[model samples]
Structure formats: structure tokens, C-alpha cells
Target: MENTATRLADIHANIARACKQARRKPEDVTLIAVSKTHEAPAIQPLIDAGQRVFGENRVQEAQGKWPALREAHPDIALHLIGQLQSNKAEEAVALFDAIHSLDRPSLLTALARAMDKAGRQVPCFVQVNIGDEAQKGGCPISELPAFLAEARAAAIPLAGLMCIPPADTEAAPFFAYLAKLAADNGVAGGLSMGMSGDYETAVMLGATHVRVGSALFGVRG
Candidate 1:
């Protein structure tokens, strides 16, 4: 518990420092502690440490854990930061407070229908394949404009853009490109880029939300 609290403080301090350097408010940048694969016992300490927002990877994995956690801490905002399958749209709509992996027309359509059925409009960040990696789950750079228009047509509450830069590379350029893409497309929501390693850089580059995992939880064994 002490370690968790200390790490949380350190991360917050770093974020504040980065924000100060970038002339941005720390409050404007949300810190989403990526809690994927971590159990409740491990998570409670962070909650106790006053960390509210968390990001999960898979719908099924999140379903198995988050319900009870949310019951205890209703203010905790759970975000789906992993690739979402079209079939799980309804469950994703019901479980997640925000969706950060919205990448395709079919999934967009599914989520729209789910929102309509549940009378809930969850904010979503359209994931961009910024590095254009074939295995990554994001809309191609060329398709983002049309995709954004399609998402708007479907009425998915736009919460800005998201991306995972190719691994083993400097992430700043990718983050800058994502910021530019959002600006060019008139996306007025928060930018959801950055993870544990480069989150501070992401904040410096105009990231509104940073998804951090191992840094907070320690290396997963």
C-alpha cells in the first residue's frame, strides 16, 4: 500500500512537472492507470491512493472484475483501451465509462446501436493506426477523415483520438502527429495517447489522457 501510494505520488509529480514545462494544466490531463490483468486486491491500494480512472484491455477480463470494484468506488471511471470486437459492443457499452479503441465502421455501428438500446452515450476516442502497423488496431491514417464523419453520423460521442505508437521507437513524433490529426479534423475532445514509458512526453505533446500500466502496477509476472 505504501509503495502504491508513493508511486502514485511520483507519477502525479512527474505529470505536474511535464504540464508545467508544456504550459498546460495538470487537471486538463487525465491519468488513466491501466489496470488490465491486475486483480482487485492489487487495485484497491491505488483506489485508496485516490487514483480514480482506470483502463482495461479486454471486455471479458474487465467484466470478470470491474463490477464489484465499481460498486465500492462508484466514482472510478473505467475505460476500454483494448481492441473491441463488434460482438461485444453491447457489453462494452454497459461496462465501460469510455471507449478508447473505436476503430472500424462495423464496431462503430454496433456501439451506436448498443447506446441507443441502453440509452447511454459513452464517449469514444477513435484509435488511429498512427504507425500504420498491420497488427495494430486503429483506423488507417487515410481513412480517419471519412471514419470520423461516419462516427459522427452514427452519433458516437467523440472524445478525441487515441493511438499506440510502434514499440521500440521514440513516441514523440507519433504523439505530435496524432495531435495534428486531431487538430486538422476539428476533433475538440481530449487526446488519448501515451502509456507508462512516454506518458510525460505525451502530456508535453498535448495528450489529454495517458494510459499507464506497468509503471503503476510494477512488472507483471
Candidate 2:
């Protein structure tokens, strides 16, 4: 594994620099080390370096490792940052500390039922298809208002907005737009935009949570 601590420090320093430029506190932004496709041995070093938040892409992948990882470090906050299937709602509710892919009514309903059954409310970041890309797995920009409203009505805790800008394009506008959407809707859950590539930009634009993967964990196999 790459030297996890050094990479984390570099990412944190970059985040600090971005926060400074934006006049925001570095502490205000949560850095979620995306641990999807990485094994527990690889993730442990980051934990040792004081990284408490992690993002996993799949329920099954996370399920395979996190339970054991969490056993050793109970303070770790695991987040679901990938497209979620309704069938896995219950498991996702039980496993993840937060959900960052709540984009559809059916998934929302499934999560609500899961939360009710589990007696735990996992905060969620509604993914917005900001680029209007057909292949993306986010709520279309047009449907966000009603979707957020539906989430609220279902009593799912909203944790701000999340988005992935179209690959290989300037991401600033998308981040800024997401910030505006959050403000317009009175969303106080904090924006969950940003990743390894454009996390600094995301931070400058008011991202409260950034999901970074390769930079910290090295490129996946």
C-alpha cells in the first residue's frame, strides 16, 4: 500500500489551503477516505493516521470488511457513496453511518422502511445529476426539489447535497451550483461533493464532505 499517512497529510494540507482561500475552516469539511475496492489491511493505516470517516461504493464490499474493521475501531464513520439498490436498503442502513446516493423515490422509501425497522436514522446526501448525464446515478436537477421534499416527508435525515461533475471537465461550476441548490432548498445537511481530483475545488465552493479515493489509497487494482 502507498504510504497512507503521507498521502492523507498531503490531502489534508491541500484541503487546508483550499479552506484558507475560501475563508472556511478546514475542520468544517469532512474528508471521507473512499475505501471501496480496498481491503481492510490497506484501510487500517489511514485509521491509524486519525481518519475517522470512510466512503464505500458497494454494500456487499463494505459488508465483507467494515464489520470487522469497525469492531477494532468503533469510532469509524462509514458512508455509502455508490448507487444503492432497494433490496440492499436494510443492509445499507445497518452498515453505513451515512448514505450519499439517495436519488430516487423508491430507494428513499426503501431506506425509510429500513431505518424504521432498524430504529436508526442514517443521514443521507441526495445525489444530483448535475451534468444531466444519462449514465449517471443521481437525481436529475429538475427533480431535486420534489425528491428532497419527499425525503423530508419520509423523515430521512438530509445531509446536504452530493454530485459528481462530468469527468474531464471543469468542476467549479457544478460545485457552486450544488451549493446554490442546497441554499435554495434550505438544506443544512452539508454538501457531499468532491473527490480525489477536484476535492480542493469542491472545498473552496463550500463542500462539507469530500469523498477521496485514489489519492489516499492509491489507484485500485
For all candidates in order, the CA lDDT equals: 0.95, 0.93
TM-score of each: 0.98, 0.97
- The model with the greatest lDDT is 1
**Model 2, CA-based lDDT:** 0.93
Deviation (Å) of 140 in candidate 2: 1.0
Q: Write the per-residue lDDT of candidate 1 for residues 47-152, one digit (tens) a residue.
A: 9999999999999999999999999999999999999999999999999999999999999999999999999999999999999999899999999999999999
* Tens-digit lDDT string for candidate 2 (86-178): 999999999999999999999999999999999999999999999999999999989998998899999999988999999999999999999
Clashing pairs in 2: 159-189, 160-189
Residue 178 in model 1: shift from native, Å? 0.3
